[model samples]
Target: MSFTCSDCGKGFTRSSSLQRHQSVHTGERPFTCSVCGKGFTRSSHLQAHQSIHTGQKPFTCSYCGKGFTGSTDLLAHQSVHTGEKPFSCSDCGKGFSRSFSLQRHQRVHTGERPFTCSMCGKGFTRSGSLQTHLRFHTGEWPFTCSDCGKRFTRSSDLLAHQLVHTGKMLFSCSDCGKGFTRSFSLQRHQSVHTGEKPFTCSVCGKGFARSSHLQTHQSVHTGGKLFTRSDCGKGFTGSTDLLTHKRVHTGETV
Candidate 1:
């Protein structure tokens, strides 16, 4: 006999399944994972949660040979190779492989920042992003590069930094055929060919391809002397000014 949940109107083959489904509405989680103290509505969900502690990934992708703890995770990973976006954003029409990813991306259009830092009033779109941002306040550099002994708060940052030590330029510009270690660097280089000056100076309205160039241009307006002559004790705005000033001592008027 089939059992049906009155609250959700969902049919289940077993009475146990119906009982488990009712727990969702009742806000009851009888089964709990001992490792992480995570509550689950059913024993099967608790069993699946235990795999996280055991590091057991039974599901393997046939396309890329990647392993996942669950079939749901494996199916999501397979979408990358197939280019199948099952989930889409209603606001921006952008597609994502996972529903959770689509939910996170939708926050961009909604301007909803659910995650916030406790130390500061700063907010982030994702909880993971907020955790990473907290490292700046905590001064926590947990992820370390084995090659260069350099440390970063996020593992992704360390992985990107490792590419610099390897000297491997995977991303290349099609216009100039110039290569870059990162895709962002390639995108910035491509802007040069497109003549897309995104960064603009507020003082003089001078446009620059890179933000660093705009920052250097802003130094001209700051009236702060960065370079100082050791011999004459005179201050200059830039290194070039210091070099030009040094010629007075050497008597080289070239």
Candidate 2:
């Protein structure tokens, strides 16, 4: 017998599955995390979240040696080694390793911004994006670097920053043999050989290999100096220009 959700009319194989589906409409989260007081619809989700507090990653990836608190996360990480993307978008034909990532990507085509910031009323495609946006209003930088004591709003930013202290260039260009701490940097470097400019400006129709370069180029049309020095109050179009200007004050020779 097929069980159906009353609210959404979604069919389920079992009554238990239907009950779980009802929680989405009811906004009911019975399981609560003791450490952070975060709520989850399922006990397994709560257990998975608890590992964040304990720092206990029992599930280790056989391919990369990376540890994950949950088996589902480990399965997702394994896709990186296998190059397997089971979840695919019907709209744009983009493949994703995880279902959650595919759902987030679908929002881009649908223009569905379900998650919204409470402070600024800005909409985001994913909850993680909303959480990161909320951090700016709350002045919360949860991720910290041990080497430099620098704080970042996102864990990915912290991970990228830590590579600077370690001098670890994990990503390398096949064309030029140049190394980069981030994969996007290597991708940008490869564009020099391929002559691919993916990021295009709406104003002047100028193409750039990197998004940062495109943003810097956009400032030329708007006449906006985004990066500013606190000491002299002088502004620059790009971060590299701002860093170069700082050397005048420090008297640093390069």
**Total backbone collisions, model 1:** 0
Best by TM-score: 2
Per-residue error for 112 in candidate 1, Å, reads 0.3
Tens digit per residue, CA lDDT, model 1, 58-140: 99999978788778788887886899998988875768889978977776556466666675444566655666766655657
Candidate number with greatest lDDT: 2
**Candidate 1: where is the Cα deviation over 4 Å?**
1-60, 66-73, 168-254
Report the C-alpha lDDT of model 2 over 146-223, residue by residue, as the tens digit.
Answer: 887887877667878888998899988887788898876786688899997766788888888765577688788888
RMSD from true fold, candidate 1:
13.7
For model 1, the run of ten residues with the poorest summed lDDT: 119-128
lDDT for model 2: 0.76
Sequence-dependent TM-score of model 2? 0.58
